[model samples]
Target: MVFYLTNLLALLAVFVILGLSFNLLMGYAGLFSIAHGAFFGLGAYTCGMLMRDAGWGFLLAVVAAFALSGVVGLILGLGSWRVTDIYLVILTLAFQVAVVGLFANLDITGGSGGLVGIPSPSVFGVELASPFRIVGLAWVLCAVVAVIVYYVVRSPYGRVLKTIREDEIAARSLGKRTASAKTGAFVLSSALAGVAGALFAVHLQFISPAEFGLGRSIEVLSLTIIGGLAAYWGPFIGAAVVVIIPQALTFLELPNSLVGALNGMAFSLLVLILLRFRPQGLLGRRSEAPVGDGGGRFAPAEGPEPAPSSAVEVRPASTATVSRDGGAPHSVTAAGAPPIEQPPPGDGATGPQGRKVRTLRCENISIAFDGLQAVSDVTLQLRPQQITGLVGPNGAGKTTLFNVLSGLLSPDEGRVLFGDDDVTNIAFDKRARRGVVRSFQDMRLFEGMSVRDNLLAALTPTAHEWIVPIGLGGGLRRPRAARADRRESADQLIDYLGLHDHGDTLARNLAYAEQKLLMIGRLLATGADCYLLDEPMSGLDQSGRDRVLRLLRDTVEAGATICLVEHSLDVVREACSSVAFLSDGCLIAEGPTEEITGDRELAAMYFGT
Candidate 1:
């Protein structure tokens, strides 16, 4: 009985690690890979071959197995950049099938018969022949993996993965290298799964291609879904239940054929029940479904309750309320100009320590999609420390132009110049690093994270650290200087945006107005020289509009260039120093706000004559 118990525990340990590995991709990175089982088999075969043919030690074999699987994982990760969603699923599935075929047909893999006589692992010439000792080894390794997982998910790097999972476009806009992050995560997951496979090969003394099929992949996937996606104990609970059910069936003395069929059926039934009843799984949070019912409109929840009329509203910090660095706060009176925040020295287009501010120029840029022109030969120059509103009709391609400037989309013709240098070929993330940042009209805050985390993620110095290993200054080594900077910056944005009350709340839970502000705060965290705001005034109440306007004015006054896309002519007339109008993807007029607004033909086209 004890021996049987140890065997079951060992199986549980193996499956637990497998489930966690899969969860790292599916749950954390939101990448549903179908090729995990192939990597597992590769690890097993590599270890088995090393031990049986080359007579390598167990520790060395295990390391080689991990590296072997990781190499394939890195290759696949790079390939995944070209595909996404259902296409990615198909791509991985095809690779997995190919791997199986290779394993079945290759002579080195022992053909279809599979590798046999894989020896049990030994430590220091002492064989772990006892089932209890094997179980102990498996569980210890499982515990180590669990601890690693715990740290990985909670670290800033883990937060970036979650951010990628939530919204890849948003992650890119904020300077995250989504492709590299995804690739790194896949490699790490594959290495861990390889470890599990090596343990399985040693314990079983053999490995068959049949054991690493699509069905096995499905089984591991089920472990995570049935337990939970983002929770630590989810894999253990799922593995425990899955391992025990087959053993329980043995007590019934069923026929071998029936037992195999029943085991598959049992897991299928459990998965179906869990998904139908609790799609978020046992430990995951329940997300509200999008309210898109037939008609193409999303009925998002309404904004937060209105502030009480009697409540004292805190005004935005301005030149009067706060000093630049360490100067006396100026006083304000009725009928005076609103307080504006002074630009920090050594920031924005300006050189470090209050040097000259640089200009960003778009030189006759044009882009098309499938022969349909989106943005046509448009040329514009954004002056230093000015708010230039890009206004046009619905299909004038305002956002497309913004995308070109921010490096989200490359123009088919022409170049973008920052100061004297042409940055037309720069990648989106690099552009962000070079101080060209943007805010989405959708307000793409990393929804599952706190407002503070959303801001912290924009601090590029620590954002890339997610891929580093724990001991090598990954999540384990918290750089006090970098962390302190992020915290200090995040706090300033929180206070500036009046998000102090909701700093700790998940971004998704915030009101729409707050979410929009949070997005602006995230852009602020980047300390960009130029800000491309999609729609700064849409959906905002009078107070909300005022707050955003104040923030924008303050940002510009602080030596940043802003190109805002807005539909509100009143806002453009009131706040913008200049306006650029577009009609049918053509730049019709651009000049002082009054000159653009006073053009009769432009007004007629803008109002749809």
Candidate 2:
């Protein structure tokens, strides 16, 4: 009984490692790879071959297994750069099959006969020869892995993984190397799985191709889902349940074949029931309801609604006078806050010469989709410290032009210049790093994160966003001063955007206007010099519009260039100094806002008279 119990505990420990490592991809990074079992098999074979052929020690063999698995995982992760979702699922599934087949055919791996005589591991010359010793060793390693995973999930790097899971595009737009992050997650997760595999081989003293197969992959995934995704104790709870269930079934005195079938049915039934009733799993958190959902956690407290007109009014603690680039002073007050006090110029606000800013210019830029021109021969320039409006009718190529300028799409015909440098070939994230950023019409905020966290995620050059630094220094590697500054900046932005009270609220929980403000806050956090805003004032009330206009004015005054894409001519006239109008993928008119709006022919075209 003692030996049986020890064996069960060791097996549980191995599965726990599998569960935690797999969660890094599926739960944290939102990647679903079915090749985890194949990686396990790779590790087992690699370790077994090395120890048997090369006479390597247990520790050295495990390290070799980890390195080999990591390299293979890196190759698979690179594939993720090209495909995702169902296509990625298919890719991994194919890989799993191929790897299992290779294991069954490779002579070096002992082929169908499988590898045998994997020696038990030793610590400092003390052989872990007994089941009790092996259990203790396995659990110790399991505890270490758990601790490592705990730190990783709690670190800034983990936050980036979650951000990628939530919205990869938004993360990329904020200058995150999302592909690299995903690749790193893959390599680390696979390496850990390899460690588990090595442990499994040593514990059993044998490894068969049958042990690591599609069913094993499904079993790992099942345990993770059953325990809870993104929960710390989830793997432990899940592995325990999975191990205990099959053992418990033995008490029924069923035949061996019947026991296997019944166990599979039990797990499948449990998964179905949990998915229907408790989708988040036993330890997973329930999704928070959006605000105004009948007094949900994020709902506004029971109180009289504030007057709509006063919603955007700033309520600073004290009044102050501020100016930008020695410009005219603006009175910043608390009550009835008419003019907002512009904060100090950000790093991207001005060039070396004060108030000098880089201009974004597109020359003869054209692009087409499905043989239909979306933007045709558009030549435009957005000058520094000014708000330029890109106005157009529906399907007029305004958004297409924005996409080209922001590097989301490359123009078929011409060059994009940022000041003197041509940035036509730069990636969108690279362009963002060069101080050009944009906001989406759909307001792609990280809905799972709080408003403050949204802004923090957008803050560039984060110190501990890489695995190496984070693993080496742990929490101390996160520069405290830099983190504090980012937090302070996030707080100031929350207040500036009139979202002070909603800083802790999830982005999805905010009202429509508030969510819009948070989007702008995220843009500001990127510290970009040029902003391309798409329908920023759309669906906003007068007060909300007023707040955005004021913020734009402040940003322009601080020496940043802006391009506003707006449908409302009134808003364009009120907020923009220059306007470029597009109609049917063509640049119909361009010049000062007053000149363009005053033209009767252009007015007719705009109003469709």
Candidate 3:
């Protein structure tokens, strides 16, 4: 029983490391990586081959393997520029398969017979042997990793990573440079896995190419899925389960094929359970300040990303964990303005005669979808520094107008011009690159990332070309650039939304009001002259509604033209100078908010008496 338990724990140790590292990328970072085998195999091979062929010390060879794995990870980081989720899975799969072929084909790897005689680690020249010793060492290593990972998750760096995973677009808007963050995550995660692989090689003293392949990759993935996505200890629980289950079955004299089949069946059942029930995983809370041990009110539950223990103490009674950084509270006013959040360049709205130029003009804009005219003959002009409200009943084409103007959907017959440039045909992403941005009514925040990083990532340009030049090829030739430049902006925005205390809180953990305003901060980072906000006040309570109105007023005061599609008369009265009412895709009224507010005909259109 002792022997069986030791072996089970041993196997579980390897998978715990794999799952933790994998979570760093997949769960917390919002990536679906399948390159675990390649990294693991490379680390294992490098350690085994170097020690065996060169007669290098066991520890030295492990270091070499770890370095080699990191290099491979850096090479793989290039994929972050243009891939995600399914695409990433495919890329890593290809790499894993290719590595297996290389191990088989290469003469150095002993070509299928595998590397043998890999001596174990020695403490001052003492060979590390015995299952008991191995388990102790392995657990120690895992503990160290957990500690380091804990810091990483809670650190500002991890905050940004979560932001990228949660909403890459939002992160880009906040100036996070999603590509750079994603690449960094890949390297970090791979290095962790590489260390694990090196240890495995040391333990076995015999290496086979088969030990590292898609099967192993699948195994690590299983650990993550079984334990939990965005779960800190889910990896450990998952590893124990997969390892122990197999070992238990083996003790029962199950055939090898039957064991594999059973694992498949068990994994399938887990998938179903996760889909139907808690999709986040066991040991995983849904969202983050931290929860009590019992799991009630799992709001703002931290993921693999650790909380700032020093910055804020976990108070079970409090809904927020207040960060002591600058003594900022949970909700505070925005810090008036930043020193460098300059508006869009070149078209600064200055005319030849020194008067401000017209920033936007929508003349007779019309759009149709499937023979339904969702927007028609909508004439509007957006000037510098004004808040405009677009209101109508449900299905009145308010969102459609935003979509058309933001370049998500093209208008059938219309002229949409911005600062003397006709961008009616521009694509949505291109418009964003050129400083035209819009937020969705659905509030698509990255599900598991912290609020601070979400805002920071939103400040970066999302285009891969701009992003790629910043992180590689001498990192755009920049010098001493810190990752927290937009942090001030993000902080200010967080303060504005009363989420300064929850800056490190995951997006999924935020109250409904918080998510709505965070999206606004994301839009603010775009530095667009013309803003299109769809249903900005949809779910806000009375206080949140007032806060949003203040934001709109302040935004317009900051010299930007905002088009808000909302239903709140008080908000419209408070923030909007001009109002455009849409009915069944047609512009029925266009005037001042006060003029339209008392209009009986428009009142009849909405509130039937």
Candidate 4:
């Protein structure tokens, strides 16, 4: 009984590591990969061969396994850049099959019979010959892995992973290289799984392709989902249950065949029950609530009714100017409150220094889908420090032009120039990093995160977003000064947007107007020089629209360029200095706002006369 218990514990430790590593991809990064077991087998085989054939030390072999597995994982991660969801799953499944086939057929891996006689591991020159000794060593490694994972999930790097999982496009719009982040996570996960594989081989003194196949991958995934995803202690709890169930069933008087079937059925039933009643799992909490369901702490509220069309007056671009570095006070007021005092710019804030006045010009751009023109030969320029409005009736291709400018879609003809540099072929994230950021019509905020976190995630200093630096610069804690600066900046923006009271509130729980404010806050956090807003005030009351317009005015006064798509003529006239009108995928008119709005022919087309 003592030996049996020791062996069980050792197995549990090995699987716990696997669960922890796999969660990095499946839970935080939102990657559904079945190739985890293949990585595990690769590690096991690498370690086993190094020890058996090369007579390498256990520690050295484990290191080799980790490196080799990580290299392969890097390849897989790169491939994942082009696929997602079901397609990504299929890609990983194929990788799993290829790996297992190699392991089963390769002579170096002992073919179908499996490798054997892997030497025992030693600690401090003491061979872990007995089950008790091996189990102790296994637990020690498990503890170390647990500590690493704890820090990893709490670091800024971990936040990026969660952001990717929530909304990859939104993350990209904030200048996050999501592909790089995902790849880093995949490599880290694969390396750790390799370590677990090493432990498994050392503990058993043998390994087979059967031990690291699709069944094993599914088992690890099941344990993770059954316990919880993105929960720290979840994998531990799950591994314990998974390891104990089959062992516990072995004591039954039933036949061996019956026991195997019973174990599979029991896990399946448990998973089904969890999916039916507790979809978030035993330890995971629901990340989002249905809008207007009153499930969040700060539910949507009906504020003051829409103000009169003339309530908001157009202000000259030069008035109410504030320092972009937050060094000067702004005259814009929020909710009739006193003018907001600017805090001294922190490291996260962008100032006007080293900035060049550039114009974004789209020259004769055209695009078609299924041979139907969405945007055709439209030439438009957005000058610096001016608010340019793009207005047209529905189906006029206003959004398609926005997509082409933002690099979400490419135009079949024409080029986009920023100043003198052509940026038509740049990736969306790269374009965003170059100071061209956009908002979405649907307000794609990270609903799972708090209002403050949503803003904080937009402040970028790429160094804080990698696994190595995060692990090296004091695990479990972010750099104090940088973190404080980012928080201060985020808090200031939150206050400016009248969301100070809801900083800790989940974004999904905020009312429609508040959510709209949060989206603007996030956009501002990017510190972009050029802004492309899509229907930013669509769902807002007049008061909400006023607040947003005030912020935009302040931003423009600070030397930023703005282009917005607004359907309300009142808003366009109040906020825009210039306008570009489109009709049926063609540019109808472009001029100063008063000139365009005063044109009877254009007005007739705009109002559908």
Candidate 5:
């Protein structure tokens, strides 16, 4: 009985590792890859082959298994980069089936006859053949894995992964290569799964294709989901329950056919019950759930509106000139009035590298969705160091054009020139790195993270700056100096944006206007040269609008370019230096704000002159 208990403990440890590995992708990264079992099989096969056929040592074989599985995971991740949700599920499911078939068919994998004689590992020449010793070894490995996972999730790169999981579009705007992040998650998770496979093979002293199949993958996934997706203790708790409960059933001495069926039925029922009552899992915090606490899906929290007395009104110019160079000094009018705020003294004046990033030229850019043209032959030369408003009626292709410029959508026609370079085909993350950043209409902040973390993540170094350690350590091993610098930057930005009091607050908990401010703070953290803001001033009251307008002017004075898409024409007339009017996928007019706003025909098209 003692020996049986030891073996059971060892098996439980192996499942813990597998559960953690699968959770890294499904829980943390929100990637639902069903090919984890295939990775496990690959590892078992690789380790078994190396040890038995090549006369390799146990440790060497395990390492080889990890590498081989990681390679396959990378390939699969790259292939499924564009697919998501149910489609991604199907894709990975197909890959898993293909791998199992290969294992069953291939002579090298021992065909239908399972590979046997997988040798047990030893530490410092001490044999671990006994069940107790095997259990000890497994627990030690599990402890190490736990430490590694803890540190990785707390690291900067892990923050990026969380952001991607929450909102990939926001992550890309902040210069995170989400596709690469997902691929890295797969590699790490699969490599760890490989480690589990190696342990399993050694413990059982045998391996078969049937042992690592769809059934095993489903079991692992259920373990994670039932425990909690975002909690650290979730996998361990889940694995314990999953491994122990089934083993306990053996005491019942049920019929062989009924045992397997009973186990499967129990798991299915547990999953259904948990999903119905606790969708976020047992250990998950209420805030960690995607939906709100009261069982409603994202019904926003309310807060006090900005007081009327705090508003800073801008003055409209009667005779604003159209100029590429610095504009003439204009005056501010009454507080909280419909007045255009003048470009404080030298708004368009160059600073440091003058005119270097002054213009973003979109030439004949066009895109169609299912034969319906979204943005047709739209062209604009946008100048820097000033706020340029993109104004048009609903469905005028304003946001569509913004998407094209920001690299969210590739145009079928024309080129996007940032100065002399043709950056039309660059990916969204790449475009962001090159100082072209955008904000979404929905304001996609990482709702799961704290407001401070959202700002800090934006300042996290690009992947190139991260130096991998000699071991398989991830971003946590990055240089301390760099991490400290980023943290300092985050603190400074938070204070600058007046979000110091709410620094520790979860982003979703913030009021609507505060959330908008947080997003703008995130944009500032990206250090982008051009800011494409979509409906930034939406949901803001008079004072909030004034604060944002002031922020925009300050940013322009500091030499950053701004292109804003707004529904409020009064705001366009008051805050923008110039305006581009679009009508039905076409640029109807582009010039000084005063010129476009005063045009009778354009006014008729927009507000029925």
Candidate 6:
């Protein structure tokens, strides 16, 4: 019975490591990797092979396992660099299968048999032969790893990872190397899994290919989701329940395989239910409910408005020059559509390289869905440092056009040139890295992370400065001079945006307008070359809109370009340098705000001229 209890405790310890590792990616980073099991397997197999074949000691095996798994994860991260969401999952799935298959037939992997007799580890000469010692070892390892996990999530590098998870494009434009950030997460996650695998092998006195299978990966994912993503304790709770419950059943006369199957079914249902009702998982703070307690799957609803959608149902954005109501010739007034607020052009444009940069050129861009044209023959440009508005009736392709420019969608025809770079083929991440950034129409910032950190993370990839560097140095790089310069810059930007006091506050802690500003701050902090304001003045009252307008001006003065997509013509009239009218994905007219509104064709389309 003591042996059995020890076994259960050891498993629980291992699961704790798994939970924390998985949560770093999902809960904090907001990346959902279905190949967690593959990472786990990589650690186990690599360590097992190194020890059994190389005659290495326990510590050596652990090192080998982590290093090998991390290397593989880095490679995989690069491979999946361009893959987003659904495609990313598919790519990971393919990689998972490939990794598992390689182990299945390889001589080093012991084929289907797996490596056995992976010799139980020892500290000095005292072998980890007794169950009590194993349990103690597992707990000690868990504690050490737990400390590291705590530090990582709270560190600057961890903050950047979460930002990337929230919105990769935004992170990129903020001067963050998103690919590298993602690779960092992958490497860290894999290393933890490898370390856990090393411990598992030592605890069990064996290793098997069958042990680290896809189901195991799913189990890891389940623990993260059910345990409550976005919070530090969520993983601990999840790991304890998952590993302890299953282990207890083994001693209760149930077969080990049966325990595995039960776990599988239970976690499957767990994920499904979480998705249906509580997408945020247990400890995760909800992003939608702008004003609520920081945790769960929920959104505040003042009315019957539909839930806003973005990547992860929490975040992601775009461009353009049009409003929905076709502007009538000679009737284009300020604040043209409802909900869009017009601000005075108080500040100048934040141009390129301290130079007044202007000019946005979209050449013959087109978009279609299932052969039906959603936006076709779309050609539009917004002058530099000036607000260019896109307006037309609903479904006129204004939003679609925004997606194309922001690299969210690849146009079926033509190309997009932002001051000369052919952005036509650039991935969303790449485009963002090159100075293009967007705010979600839905406003999806990291809900659980501190509000101040949200802004900081936006600047993180670009700031490249730090208060102090970590010993591991696997995450954020912090040199004194760079760090000081960035902090000063960030502090000034935050103060200018009137969020200096709220820097330490979590995103969900803010009000609706505050959240919007937080997002805007993120863009500014990240150093967006091009600011695509998608309904920026949406959901704002007069004061909030005024504040945003003021910020826009500040951006222009800071040398940033601005493009406004809105339904309000009055707002455009007061703010835009030029306007492009879109009707059913086709550009009906383009010129100075008044000239385009005066076009006879556009006037008729908006309201029978």
The list of candidate 3 runs beyond 4 A from truth reads: 1-9, 123-126, 129-137, 267-277, 286-382, 389-438, 447-518, 521-532, 538-547, 557-561, 565-574, 578-609
| Ten-residue stretch with the least lDDT total in model 5 | 318-327
Q: State the C-alpha lDDT per candidate.
A: 0.77, 0.80, 0.68, 0.80, 0.76, 0.68
Selected candidate, larger lDDT, 1 vs 2: 2
RMSD of each: 5.2, 4.8, 9.3, 5.4, 6.4, 9.1
Judging by lDDT, tell me the better candidate of 2 and 5. Answer: 2
Between candidates 1 and 3, the one scoring higher on TM-score is 1
Clashes of each: 2, 0, 22, 0, 8, 44
> For candidate 6, lDDT tens digit of each residue in 77-189?
78767777888788888887888888788987788987887776777667777788888888998898788788787666676777677666555545556676677777788
Clashing pairs in 5: 314-339, 315-339, 315-340, 315-341, 316-339, 316-340, 340-574, 604-609
21: Cα error in model 2, Å:
0.6
Model with the higher lDDT, candidate 2 or 6? 2
Question: CA lDDT of 436 in candidate 4?
Answer: 86
- The residue-by-residue lDDT of candidate 2 on 1-609, one tens digit each, is 998899999999999999999988888888999999998888888888888788888889988998999999999999988899999999999999999999999988889889998877877789889999999989987998888888788766788888898899998887777898899888888988898998889989899999999988988899999998887788888999889999999999999999999999999999999899998888987766566546443233222344545444454552223222122323222243222223333324553225446789999999999999999998988866678899877889999999999999999999999877899999988888777888898888998778888877776354457777534313556567755765766676677667767788878878776777778768766667788999998887666676677777766665567898999989998888888989998899888889998989888877788
Which regions of candidate 2 deviate over 4 angstroms?
Answer: 293-356, 462-464, 470-476
Per-residue lDDT over 1-609 for candidate 3, one digit per residue giving the tens place of the 0 to 100 score: 787677667667777887888888888777888889888888888878777788777667766876788778878888767877778878888988999999888888889988888776665577668878878777877887686666566544566667766677655433344576677778868877887887788777888888998888888887788788877889988888877766666666778999878877877787679757877778777644443345432222223322222112222332211111122122222323321123332445552223343476678998888898888788877545667788888889988888887777888898788877898997665566555677777877775666776665554333321212222322233332433444665666666555657788776666666677677866765555567887788766565665566656555545556888888787787667778888898889887778998899998896655
**Candidate 1 on 123-144: residue-level lDDT in tens?**
7787888898899888988998
Runs with alpha carbons beyond 4 Å of true place in candidate 4: 287-355, 469-478
After TM-score superposition, what is the CA distance of residue 148 in candidate 4 from its true location, in Å?
A: 2.4
Q: Which pairs of residues have clashing backbones in candidate 1?
A: 343-558, 346-353
How does model 1 fare in lDDT?
A: 0.77
| TM-score, prediction 4 | 0.89
